[model samples]
Target chain A: MLSIRNLKVTVAGKQVLNGLNLDVKAGEVHAIMGPNGSGKSTLAQVLAGRDGYEVTAGTVTYQDRDLLALAPEERAREGVFLAFQYPVEIPGVNNVYLLKAGLNAIRKHRGEAEVDAFEFLTLVREKMQLMQMNESFLNRAVNEGFSGGEKKRNEILQMAILEPTLALLDETDSGLDIDALRVVSNGVNSLRRADRAIVMVTHYQRLLDYIQPDHVHVLTGGRIVMSGDKSLALELEKRGYDWVKEDSAAA
Target chain B: MSLSAINQPAAALDHYRALFASRNVPDDALGKLRRASLERFLAGGFPTQRDEAWKYTSLRRVESRRFAPADAMPIGADESQWIADAGHRLVLVNGRYMPTLSTPAPQPPGVTILTLAQWASHSPTQVADFLARHDHAAPHATPPTANGAFEHLNGAFSDDGVVIDIAPNVQFEQPIYLVHQWCMPASARSAGSHMANPRIIVRAGAHSECSIITHWVGDETAESLTNAWLTFDLGVGARVSHLNLQEEPSRSFHIETTRLQLATNAHFGKHDFALGSALGRSGTLVTLGGPGANVSLNGLFAPTGTQHLDTYVHIDHAAAHTTSQQDFRGIAAGRGRGIFNGKVVVQPGAQKIDARQSNRNLLLSNTAEIDSRPELEIYAHDVKCSHGATTGQLDPVSLFYLRSRGLGESEARALLIRAFAQSMLSTVQVGAVREWLEARVQRRFDLSAGEHS
Candidate 1:
């Protein structure tokens, strides 16, 4: 479903991602494990088409289309979603209002009818229940005055609502507690299907215990150094990343 | 001073002098007020930016035009049908009361509604007493001395207006709507632009409660000027809500000054909306005279396409336990300039006074400008007072958040602007008026797509 070949990226005159390559097929879940400052978030941001990131040399193809050429909103309309590490607090903008606009935009792009307010509210309420959020969450400002766990849950709720083709979960499990982690993992697992893909970027192996990935890749110094099954996550958690770094250096 | 600044509007003064002479009733009390007012206006002339209160607003548009007091022009009933829902409409065309155009409710025994001329003829002593108490104590009454220029001008040239009096303990459920319409004269050069100066006096006796909605509109094609002055007095334990809407033509000018006096436990709330006019200014001065009195001054202005709007507010906490709040917002686009100056004063011995002032502005274009200043003066100890002013573009993070949610850039911008406007507009207690103002705001932004709910 997505391909990245030799992705080289720079931000503010500093190189962040250097010659990183990854590929994922349809319905596959890939977990990119990396240490701090390894450009994991940068890869997620680049895929979602955020500004200020200069792609020095790379090619990202998604569903037979050049993804980097589209604007941020166009990429969203084309069914690309990014669950931010830190969700932005936008005061005065209603949560359900935004979800409706997003859903209608994607539906319009696919030549479908727009969802009316009543129907949209019904759809959002169901997702809200799945995310374990209260009804008042729909009326409050988007993420304003929300706690860390609440923000993470809001990101997952948005992902569930948009139903994107390729979902990039950037550190989604960093600040969540055990209960919130269960809820968010349940929400993501419910979205898994044959035609959809999810890429989870994390620093710890706790989230994999809930939502296991098909393939596990350890990212060190902006490049994928090792690939293994889910047991590698447990191995990294038990032994740490220094072994992989030393092994890659020796290779 | 510069030559242009020193050059007074001679034609305007001449026009006022002629009108005063034509209507001067010798040895009458109203004439006495007019004569003294004319002399005061002559002394001050037209205020320039040199005046500290009017530093950001200029009256060049008002001084350049030669305007005569508007005559009673023929207006068809269809012209005012849109304002039909307004209860007890008192229509004034060209500063002249049109009995045929007005629809007043049946007055109770203690409630009195009549034109200023009729009041002078019927109850001259009472009229003299009211005008005397306001005009003599005016300089020290509400705004001190800085805001007396326009009040003096309106007093000098006000030919006709409405007087509403509510007796003790009277509760008026329906609002009294005053519609001041200025139709263009046939000849702009010969007859000059219309200058409609209407005076409104609202007095609520002890324990009385009421609401008033004042609308100012002018011809869209003609050059006109509206210099209005309103005085409100709330007796002990009275409550009053006043909404002032200025919707003049884009090529015209509108300036208004409102003076308020709140007695012990009196509640005075005002909503000043300046949404139109080529050059518009609305100034409000509220005085909390007795202990436990409270006031709220909330206003908003949106100007685009070379329009200039200014809102000035001053609140005085003169007694202990009094509270005052001021919330003003401005939106400028396409070279539009908006100015907001708000000041709060907590006098000596006024303990436990609570005062808050907030002014937020949005500049939609690079050429648009906003000048906002919020000031506080506290001579009393043990008081709580705070003020804030912010002028900037929309938040980039918020914009990106909305755009990433599949809203187009313009749609996202409109949503944020609407939310900003709603903050001030939602304060209007009247549902119908709030809805009408919301529609007007939507039209002002040309936003046709988004749901306003």
Candidate 2:
């Protein structure tokens, strides 16, 4: 469902993602683990089409289409969702309002009818329940004054509503406590399907324990240094990234 | 600033003096008041940038025009659309009362709604008494008039407007809607610009409560000016809510001055919504006279094109335990310019006074401009007062977030701007008034195309 070849990205004249490569097929979950400054977040940002990241040389293909050429909003309409590491706090925009707009835009892009308020409300309420979000959360301004865990849960709620074909989760478990982490992982687990793909970028192996990944890749110096099964995350968790850094250096 | 050069508008001065002479005004106390006001206007011709109060706004556009007194033009049936939803309405055309267009409901026992001309001729003694009792020079706690030229101009050329009086302990269930329409015929525009000076006086007696919605409407193509003055006096323990809606066309100019005074334990709340007019200025002065008096002033102005809107507000916390709050918001798009200057004063010995003032502005375009100044003057030792002002564009992150969600760029902007302005519109406790304001806001923002989604 997604392919990237020699993804060389630079932000502010500094190479963030140098010659990084990744590939994922439908019905599979992939986890990219890296220490700080290993371009784990850069890869997610590049895939999501955020501005200010100059692609020195790369190609990202999604569903047989050139994803890098699309605008951020266009990518969103094409079923590409990015669960930000830090959800922005928008003071005046309502949470449910943004979700409805996102859903309707994707539906419209797919040549479907726009959902009416009543139908949209029902869909949102069910999704909110799946995320265990209170009804008042729908009326509150988007992420404004929300706790760290609450913000992470809202990102998951949006992902569930958008139902993107390719989802990029960037450190979704960073600020969550044990209880919130369980709830967020449950929301993400419910979104697993045979036709969808999720790529999670994280530092620790804690989230991998909940939403087990089919494949784990260790990134170092902006490149994928090692690729293995779920056991690789446990190995890295026990030994830390220094062993991987040494191995990459020796290679 | 040299005083002579600042006060030199001989042509405009001559025009107004000529109109005053033509009027058949009596030489009684009321007439002397008019003369005194005219002299004051002459002493301080038209406010210029040199004046601290009018620093950011220029009256050159108004001074350059040669405006004659507005005539009693005919009111078409279509013009009545402005007051169609009003249950008890008093309509004025070119500052003159239009009984035919008015739809005044049967009044309650102690409520009186009559035009200034009718009150002057029919009840001269009562008019004199009311004017004398609240004389400007009297030892009242209310602040003096703030807008010199406009207030004096309105008094000098004042033609006629509605006077609503509620007797003591009389609570009016229905609001009195005053619609002032200023429109010049196509031929009149050829002769010269037209101007109308309308004055309204409202008195809420002790323990009484009432509301009044004043609307200013004009022709979209007319090059006219409407100078309006309103004085609201709240008696002891009275409550009154005033909503002033200024919707003149872009080619028209509007100068409105409102003076509100509250007595012991009285409460006065005012909302000023201005969206139209090529050049508009709204000056409001609120005074909390007696202990426990409270005043709330909320204002919102959204101007596009080359429009210029200015708001000047001053609140006087004169009595102990009095409270006052002022919230003003402005959105300037295109080449529009918006100015807001709010001042709150806690007088000497006014202990326990609480005052708050804020002015928030949004600049939607590179060419748009906003100048906000919030001032606080506290003489009392035991008082709480705070003032602040902020001006900027929509948060870039917020805008991007909205766009990424599928709202068109314009739709996203409209939603955010509406939310910002809604902070003030929601303060309107009256449902009908709020609904009317919402429709007007939607129309102004060009959100009529299902942009609410």
lDDT of 1 by residue, B212-263 (tens): 9998886676577788888899999999999888888788888888888999
**Docking quality class, candidate 2:** medium
Q: Write candidate 2's Cα lDDT for B416-436 as tens digits.
A: 787788788888877777888
i-RMS for every candidate:
1.4, 2.1
Instruction: Give iRMSD, candidate 1.
Output: 1.4
Best by TM-score: 2
For model 1, the superposed segments whose C-alpha errors exceed 4 Å read B1-15, B22-27, B77-86, B108-110, B136-139, B185-191, B446-453
Per-prediction DockQ scores? 0.65, 0.52
CAPRI grade, predicted model 1: medium
In candidate 1, position B85 carries an lDDT of 73
Residue pairs with clashing backbones, model 2: none
TM-score of 1: 0.93
How do the candidates score on chain B by TM-score? 0.93, 0.93
Task: Give the alpha-carbon lDDT of every model.
Answer: 0.84, 0.85
